[model samples]
Target: MATLEELRKQLDTIDDQIVHLYEERMRVCEAVGEYKVQSGKKVYDQTREKAKLADVASKVSGEFNKKGVQELYEQLMSMSRKLQYRQLVQAGALGRLPFIEVDSLEKETARVVFQGTEGAYGQAAMKHYFGENCNCFHVHTFRDAMEAIEDGAADYAVLPIENSSAGSVVEMYDLLEEFENYIVGETIIPITHTLSGLPGAKLTDLKKIYSKGIALMQASHFLDEHADWQKISVVNTAVAAKKVLEENDPTQAAVCSAYAAQVYGLEVLADHINNEKDNYTRFIIVTNQKIFLKKATKISICFELPHESGSLYRILSHFIYNDLNMSRIESRPMEGKSWEYRFFVDFEGNLANPAVKNAIRGLREEARNLKILGNY
Candidate 1:
């Protein structure tokens, strides 16, 4: 065997040759892009790329090298496709997107809808986003809000999408697929749960607690202290507070926001009771129209991947090659497809950006049923 320094020198020399070959390969890819641009052909030639992967894998010696070479060629081909997409964009060959771009979202006069009753966190998020005095109504469930927007009963809907501590609101992701609503914006609100009861009720007076199921879970630490208290789940935290006030039961209290307690005429017996002090929930502003603002900087998209080895990795390479920053990803079971999933990804890039266009172009070709949920 060669000494360590001798092996390092040989590896460096091979790497230098690889670098030169990479540049030459990219130059050839540019020519291919030009030909496709003039011929009106798609950048992703699936048939050709599949053959190339198989050919490269066969040329390698062992099983490990075969898999490694295939993976390497997959990335190279993805980079070539992205380069082709960029060339198309530069030549004005990239077609218009399905979504319409608007200068701004209608805020002042637009009617808005949110789930839950007065003093709900959803209500607070809606108010903060659309302005405090914005015209808005309340519904009983998140699904109802989606329906309201779909039926044109409301111009917009505000619903929670995720929580920092508890993770994603899975129902929201499902609703996005079921409804035609598009997310135009989002807001984050700090969630500080309080244990409240009718005026003058003390913690020791409490025999039971009522709140949204998630709220009760979040305040588990505080509730664990009084394990004997019967914890009941309700539709909304505000609804729980309303029920406590309506019942006028001294032994009953609610886990809700301080605003909710105040709105329902309840005394906040305990404040900041949630296990996670810095807990926050992200809410999305959804509208019926498929429109995004001109300066929107983030996009939400969903796609189902084929059931094949390295499929997910190959699809994600488009984002990596284009230098797109993916902020979040969530997988939901695909309906009627057992053991398969559709992925929802949130990434940072405007629709008008060329790099974004390049990535989406490649992703759409490779991903099954790809949908751009919104760019905002």
Candidate 2:
């Protein structure tokens, strides 16, 4: 029944009191952080947080209010944990990460490996990252490339991770989880697919078209035009070109890069056959060593979340509270767990930064099986 102005003043007074109490609460949390630092205790205590939420909910009225109070406390507790983490970082109590920091990759003496034949996009990415004249070899499959680095047969391996038009190269993500190899760097190359065949072969003479599965999908517009042409998926585009050249059949053509066609001595019958003109593919450079470049600005990590509401959001809040910018996130099914998934996230931060360490520490405690894939 009070006037609108009187009601607004009452709300303002409550807000001021709430701010004062919030600062007082933070001061108490700081004291707790100091005690934990001296006692070697962890910042995140899941059991304590569960109990605190229950206690707060009991003090509130109605189902909606109970839920609201629980959510509010969850955020307040998360902020408290973050503050403690920052204190630990400042006190040098946060342990060193497993990754070693290096001034530069040993490009001069490092042996590189790539998937498929000589002219695959992986080879182009390798040349661009490691240098054109770097020592390198080819592997038959992506698994083979991963193994080459895992077994120390090669110091590094170049593999395609994603495509602009076709989306993620899913097998690569699975392979990353399956292997111990870590990414050290990345390179993106513009993709320009061409239809090529024997020196004298014409587009009209093509009976079958061959390329990698993703390549065929990317050039769907051009392939759809030649509906009569049978499409075959190979291990790599370069391999397709090699197949066409070795068959000596004018009826068979390949969808590949101009460089690949030239490598296999095939003549281009059609150029730029991809559906998107500005297509590109991102490639990752992986190695067996758990080391990161001193100047690396990006970090890739993967983790499995508990099957609870807001789990992903809670995990991601670490990045927000630490002021880290996440650039990409992708999820893949956990190998044996149906419906549940594992998440891969790419964020902007170097492992050496204090804020980066603080976020990672909080994530390690809250997320299950959190793995730092790389920092590059």
Candidate 3:
């Protein structure tokens, strides 16, 4: 066996050769990119890529070496594809995106709808985004809010899409995919849950606690401290407070926002019982039209992956190639399709941006049912 220092020296020499080869490969890829641009041909060629992968893998000896070489080349090719995509963008070869760009969201005279009753977090988010005096109404369910927008009963709808400590509002994601709503803007509100009850009710008098499922989970530590308390899921925390007051039961309390409790004429029994002190819930302003603001800096999209190996990696390569920063990614089971999932992704860029255009073009060509949810 060679000494450790001798092996290190040899490895360094091999790395130098690899770097030089990599530069040469990139130059060739750039030439190919130029050719494709001139020929008006598509950037992604799946048939050619598959053949290349197979040919390269066949040259390796052992199974381990074959797999390793294939993986390495997969990454290298993906990087090359990204470089080509960038070249196309710089050369003004990327085409227009599907979404219509708007100067601004209609807020002053627009009618808005929100899920849950008055004093709900959705209401607060709507007010925060659309000004305190904006025209808005409440709906009993998130679906109802979506329907309101779909029916043109409202210009926009405010709905929660995610929470900081408790993770995503998954139902909202499903609804977005199910409906034709487009997210135009997003707002984040700090969440501080409190246990509230009737004025004379004590902690000992509480038999059941009602709140949204996520809110209950966020306050799990505090609720767990009192194991005897029954937990009930409601539509929203504000709705739970409304129920507590309507029921007029001292035995029932609500785990809700302080504003909700106060608005519903309840007294706070405990304050800030959430697991994380800096918990926040992100709300999206959605509309029925497929429009985005011209100044929008973030985009959300969803797509279903083909049921084949390396499909996801191939799709993500578009983002890598365009140098787009993906902020969040989530997956939900595709409706009516067992064991198959649809993915939702949020990335930084506008629809009008060349890199964004390049990424979306490649993704639309490759992924199934690629939908641009919004640019905000």
Q: Give the top-scoring candidate (TM-score).
A: 2
Candidate 1 regions exceeding 4 Å error are none
TM-score of 1: 0.94
Residue 84 in candidate 2 has what lDDT? 93
Clashing pairs in 3: 82-321
Q: TM-score for every candidate vs. truth?
A: 0.94, 0.98, 0.87
Candidate 3 structure, TM-score to reference: 0.87
List ranges where model 3 is wrong by over 4 Å: 1-28
Report clash pairs, candidate 2.
none
lDDT by candidate, in order shown: 0.92, 0.93, 0.91
Give me the displacement of residue 181 in model 3, in angstroms: 1.8
Kindly report which residue stretches of model 2 are placed more than 4 angstroms away from their true locations once superposed: none
lDDT of 3 by residue, 54-94 (tens): 99999989999999998998888877777777777778776
Candidate 1 C-alpha lDDT tens digits along 1-376: 9999999999999999999999999999999999999999888878998899899988979999999998888878878888888898889886898789899998999999999999999999998899999999999888999999999999999999999999999999999988888999999999999999998898887898999999999999999999889999999899999999999998999999998998999998999999999999999999989899998999999999988888898888888888999999999998899989999999999898889888887888788988888888
